[model samples]
Target: MNKSILRVAPMVLSTALCTTAFAYTVQGTVTSKADGKAIADASVSLLQKGKSAKTDQDGKFTIHEDEQDTTSTGIHNQQAVGFVNLSQGVLHYSQSSGPVQVKVFDLMGNLVSSKTLYGTGSVDLRQGINAKGTYFAKVHVGSATQNIKFTTDGNASAYSTSKTKSALLKAGDTDKLQVIADGYDTLNVTLNNLDTTLALSLEKSIPPEPTYKFGYALKNTPTPSKGCGTNTTLKTDKKVENGEHHVVNVNGTNREYFITLPTNYDNTKQYKLLIALHCYGSSAEDFVHHTPDYDHPTPYYGQQVLDKNGDYIFASLQAVGGLWNKGQEDHDFFGKALTTIEDNYCIDTSRVFITGFSYGAMFSYSLAQDYQDRVRAAATYAVADYNIWLPQEKGMDKNLPIAWMNVHGVNDDRCTFDKAKNSALPRMLKKNGKASDGDSQFTDASSEILQENQGSTGHLCYDFKNVDERFPIKFCTWPGGHQWTAHDTGNMSVGWNWESTWVPEEVHKFFEQF
Candidate 1:
């Protein structure tokens, strides 16, 4: 978890300069703000009286001021320079704000280097020996600042340890560094042993509002309407009959989620299962609204609850951060949800599926990659491409033998379909061991429509269908951008008639074919 250190008692600034009698050394580490992970290549420095010392790869620094041994040198009694440490993360650029700033000052209150960095980039300082005094350093990004103060006695060699392993960390682990520079607040950082990755970025303040808010009590939400009969009512008890909405503890946090029973559900019947993920700021009900046929039709059914005809049960879960696990400790929350569903329902062990929309779709993609043994297939909507957050597959060796399908809109403003062609298709083809000779480039036609002319361009079937040797990953693009087109809506509906010009029906047929 990323945490912001709200406040700390400022380090007492001392004019007390380092003399030849005092040992002068300073050490620390740098890390990512997203997840408190450490970063490498960050530069640490100690500055005094117009002099500075650069930190080694380990983010450690040593500053010495005097080479001549003299009893009179001890009488200088003035701290001259300040200390500055800087590091950023891989995803540091994701922030709306630009680069982070680093500032250094001498013990006599003279300013030195003031540099700004875009990423967890590191830089060395210039302070050296024969400079006896204290120094001040500050790190600033936007309105946030962290400060630090240090003193150096010119005696021992000032060794830099940028790449050296810190005694504070085990051989393979990183350490956290606390920094407060000239003009900013304190920045608590985690530096990794390898210094190649960053976990997260966080401010010292409380986290912002969650992306999703459940309004089960409100209409137009995903909850079953009152007219859907006793089983569909929000107040329906779990123990009385077959119903959704189970309350369970996720890592000790109480949460309620909806479960879909198979149409053939019987007390004695066991079935396969599927986990459905929701997008950011969305709920389990959102999927149902998108797939209205999952609900029994009114009027003719007359308040009778509809049973799912599919052989698998569906579970819609709520996440702590308005999303499925995002490579954080809260990932345990997703694991907890899985156990809750398996414990409460008669789920088949060998046939679990995962799917979602937007954020949910990304989660589904992540689960398929990470939990390959647990999931047999994955289907995602509105996810056209992959990135550092949701990386695309690499090769057949990396494929998990799980079926994959993605629904994307060409005009999607959030995730363009064309952007996904390189990463997504390569991974998919490598999994299936199938490749196409034609150009794999896909052009973004519009927000709602994308056309791949290199291969087959048609309404229903794509050009490279089922070409991979492992489980085939399929891509479906709509002409519109970021919208559920008539085709997508058809696929979301039930009993979609492929011959009736209903696009949703074709989508159902597509899923049923597997």
Candidate 2:
């Protein structure tokens, strides 16, 4: 007994010393390198230990080594699981392994809903939990499990669900420290020391490079047109008070259009021109002042409100008999109106943009192809290739690239999402130089590439990266039907009002990027 005790005594002491030696407290502060400002709510993780923490408002986080489970021997490999908030209180999971089990629980740990998805799919929380609040999800895939914390109020958290206050680290063990935040580039650092404080600076994520293949980049400098230093005249019989109303003669028929200039309009300064088109049965006057609901008096699809800086000159073009007639008549009207606008205002020739909804959206898409050389960019909502005749019959310049953005609802039976995905989106991607294989991957609804965009509360926007760098293309899909603004309309149960007005904001942002 004495010999045995003597042998075990050194071993016990050595184990104690080993644990003490590895005991470390790791703390860090994450800040933006651009401004050296604290980045709050950033996720910091010790990758190997499967430990993570969220930075406080002060951008400080602490992790303790003792919190690690010592019995777990293998390194914790990070999974590629991701989650996004879908419309009507649904949680979408993607890039997960097969037989994925998801258990959603409220803050009180009550299991709200539980289901096992085949691979990538969604769980409608409205079926189980009716209230809007913070919830936690536990996802199990094969041998790996991940936790996700999310809010039902449309704010979806990052993919990582690890909320451990501390991480485990053995002495002299090198571990990867990763930091991630919205609008910032992800950071990864190898840590070789412990019991030390760290200051990490994250760089802001750069916007995608502008192609300058079209738009302002095409011109050597801003060109002032004949319309400079002249006030616009109204030729229409209808009385207009707010904007300059004019009528253009296209093949003996009169085409009416309304133009709204910046309040501080300067003739010498060339301004970006935005041409907006109205849907079928909707007049340009109605398009300008029509109130969608009590909350939104949508003027110029809300671009006028967004342009607080008054950098854009707005134009609303009226369709012939409140319908965009097929063939070259509407096209001629568009060209003539554009020329008239350029003749009236100090327009930036290279910075002309177009946006429209429904039938107007179709026209905008047509014009984008027909006038790819003249128009800088085009953004359209609820567009289809079949309903409105395209200028392709006149021979579309497939070589000329134009930055394009399309917002379509997956449930749009009128314009149809199928046509948008199969026909419209493919055409734009092809024109933008996206490879056929890549375009096929994106346009295929059953493909994983398209499936990954399933659940978004407002909309899921996919940028075709394989396309021409100068002419980027984006396709966004929402949950509502054929409507300009995706208003919930009670049937869809899209809980937020912001969804109704998200299109204009998205359009404004997309155009501003150019």
Each model's lDDT comes to 0.43, 0.67
Candidate 2 structure quality by residue, lDDT tens digits, 1-514? 0000001122232343233222346798999999999999999988766678999999999977553332242222233233333333355655443465667877655788898777456766445555667665555544333344445543332222223312222223346889999999999987744446899999999766333323333234566777777775534455464576788899998888998878988977888899988888777876566656522356777788888888889899998778886468899999999998898778987788998888888899889878976798998888888767777766754445578888877888899988888877767765666334432222312221342135544567787666644467778777777766754342256354643556677778787776
Report the number of clashing residue pairs per model: 80, 4
lDDT against true structure, model 2: 0.67
Residues 28-48, model 1: lDDT tens digits: 444445455454434333322
Residue 439, model 1: Cα distance from true site in angstroms:
29
* Candidate of highest TM-score: 2
